[model samples]
Target: MQTFATLRTPQTTGLPARSGAGMLLMWLGIVTFYRIWVLPRLGITLYVDEAQYWTWAQQLDWGYFSKPPVVAWLIAASTALFGDDLVAVKLSAILLYPATAWLLFVLGRQLFDTRVGLRSAVAFSLLPFVSGLGLFVSTDAPLLFFWALAILALVRATSMDRWRDWLLLGVALGLGVMSKYTMLAFGASALLYLLLSPQRRAQLGNPRLWAAIALAAVLVMPNVLWNWSHDFPTLRHTADITHVEGINDKGGNVGEFLLAQLASLGPGFALAFLAGLVVAWQQRRDGRMQLLVCFSLPLLAIVFLQALRSEANGNWAAPAFVTATVLAVVFLSRLKTRWWIVVIALNAGLMLTVYHVRDIYRIAGKPVPASLDILKRARAWDVLARQLRPIFAAHPDAMLLTENRTLMAHLLYELRDMHLQHAAWKPQAIPQDHYQLTTPLGPEDLGRSAILVTQSGSAGVIERFSSHQTLAHVSVIAGPKLRREVDVILLEGFRGYR
Candidate 1:
């Protein structure tokens, strides 16, 4: 291994630089285009979250019930420019991953050299999760993009202390905050980086740093005010979801989360990443290596504990990988050539397998085995929506009443052409989701007739109506793993739920 002092300077080993840049660009463009056009027609429907985000996009706001407005705004812009096709709904994710990969390229070029930059871009572009998830839109897309951009800005600001770089830092950070609350952790990571470097800590006394902080605060203030007016639903929802206050010793949960993350990043890169963290820590005397560890470790440490406490999804710590990718590449660069080849081959294999899974199965003349069809949740959603369409057509005057989040969001988009008035069947005073918080049927809507849609007929909601009848029993074979069935009930003259 190279000495610790050498870690201070980049060691650019043999890798193509100039020609690689051109090739990487071409690959990114083709992948992005495929996601935009081809993926939509490949026997998949919008995932529930994608459909919900589409509903949010229809009416732009400063804040939303469960999240900030950035995701909604992103979908709105994509659909507005591209039209309301399934491709439009997912256009944001389709485009942002490539942009994030480019940010990594730029940052790697800045910190190391063009070779590392080109390789970093190629590695990130092919991550199993990035390649697979990029086809579906969600809040994670904008969150990760803004996060990578902010890391780029921080690197420049620390190196040159330029005003423009600081401003970019503030804007990227504020946008990250709007994209996902997890971004607040970025501040902690930044602080940890500065405090660890004695020379860099002197910049804490500089005016530009404070100015960046203030600018971020100002930019994020609107969402805070929006939350204030709305009783802080976003914060509450986050707490409820994470259950951060309720902690218990669940060793198995921590192991489950780690394994899930291993699957997400792919086994090769994930193992290399952990090994890199240890190597970087040993070279902590080098400020460059220190920067990588500070950014990667703290967020992951939090998520690791979070899983032990309650639970964490595999992607919860995705932003942490923004810097970890560079560290992993740096660590792997010094190893034998075969190690690099193995990582490349593994990532490329995952990309090809996931991207063309349907084609591969079809060519073999076999149905996509449930084991390989990760799009199971997205399958047949449009078909189910089409099945529900005739019910609304038969009762045009009756308002649509949803008894759960899934129906509220899916129907809002699936049946958008009908333009039926809709409300959530919320019995409790405290809101559980976006629909319950905003459009719940209440005392004011007592006299309005409605059709209650639910998996189980909610007796509480049915009793609120003056008269009720079982309208229809709807069923759809959604996928190999999912068989959906619902009860559609007609209720007239809704009586107030007292």
Candidate 2:
């Protein structure tokens, strides 16, 4: 095995670093312009998740029921500066991707050559997941950015054994955790790297490593405390989804998840990434290859196993791709440029299709089916809100109530100017979401009228009210290719929370 001193030595590559930096800047400028100026004007309504985060941003907290508070914090910061418009809600996502791309470029250049760095950044930017991320607000935006930063810091810390680098790695890990719980995977990979690498194993005894761990713990302490005070709802929610406790017969889920990952990464890039994984395994003796593999593979394996046991979303392994992008580019760079170019072209086409999906469907003279249109959530909210405005104006004293969290979020954001009281139904139970937890219609609301909106009229809800009447039956268009109508019923005269 190579000694630590030998492994720490940086390799000199003939690739022009200045040119690579210039290319990164150019890409950043293009992406920034499109995201900031062009995409927001395309008339895409905010998705339910984005609206939910915006609602959360209005009442900033240390933690939320479904995830930590960083995403909400980010949205809050952006909307504060830019106002609570669609562009403002999604600003963090737009801005963060360029920073993530820049980090990928720098990490690749540090590990390999300028060509690899440029390719890796481009590959990351062109990912199908990124296509969605660039226009939508979600936890993935900040999680991915910090994940890449953590990996880069990990490389520097392991290779240089520098105290400052280790401290920086801790800060990144802490912030990543704040962004999303999946960041624990990166933390696990970092631990495994320290334990497995013979050359850097001596760092185990270094106080700096322990200090880094302590620093991360300190940074996340507030969130942990918040969870404790809130009956550990965040932990419970995470476990409920991940443990698959009540789920059975997950036999096909793993296969479905793998396929979804292929689609999410873009098929061409997925194949290249898998190939790069094999090459990294074959070249494990190289310290840099080992570092990349350590950061990239463990999270994917964990999510794959989770899929086998239960269900995993395609984006569950998103952070894994941060390092995987560099790995794929490094391996693909050894091949003819034509191979990677074809992949880039395919991915670019997919991204363009996603961006102009409505236009494409309109041009084809076809109604995008709800099943095929992934962007259906970003539609219909505006229409629904407009229809509800008159009903809300008619019942000035009535509060708004919804059984669905998604509806509650959309309505909350859409009717924000009304200043009407709203709450999610949680009769005889604990809160399931931030809205329910924060806005409980208890004894004080008894005999108070409410405008109840739900997917379907519930007998239980009718029984609790003094008198109920159906106001309007609205059809919401959802999905892209094969559009579907979702019927929403508006009810009035809910007298209490019973």
TM-score of each: 0.94, 0.93
Over 201-311, each residue of candidate 2 has an lDDT whose tens digit, in order, gives 877787888888899889899999999998998888887777656554645388888987888788888888899889988987777787788887898898888887778
Provide C-alpha RMSD values for all models, in order. 2.9, 2.7
Overall lDDT per candidate, in order of appearance: 0.82, 0.80
Kindly give the stretch of ten consecutive residues in candidate 1 with the minimal lDDT sum.
Answer: 1-10
TM-score, candidate 2, is: 0.93
lDDT of 2 at 95: 84
Model 2: how far residue 33 lies from native, Å: 2.0
Stretches off by above 4 angstroms in model 1 are 1-20, 248-252
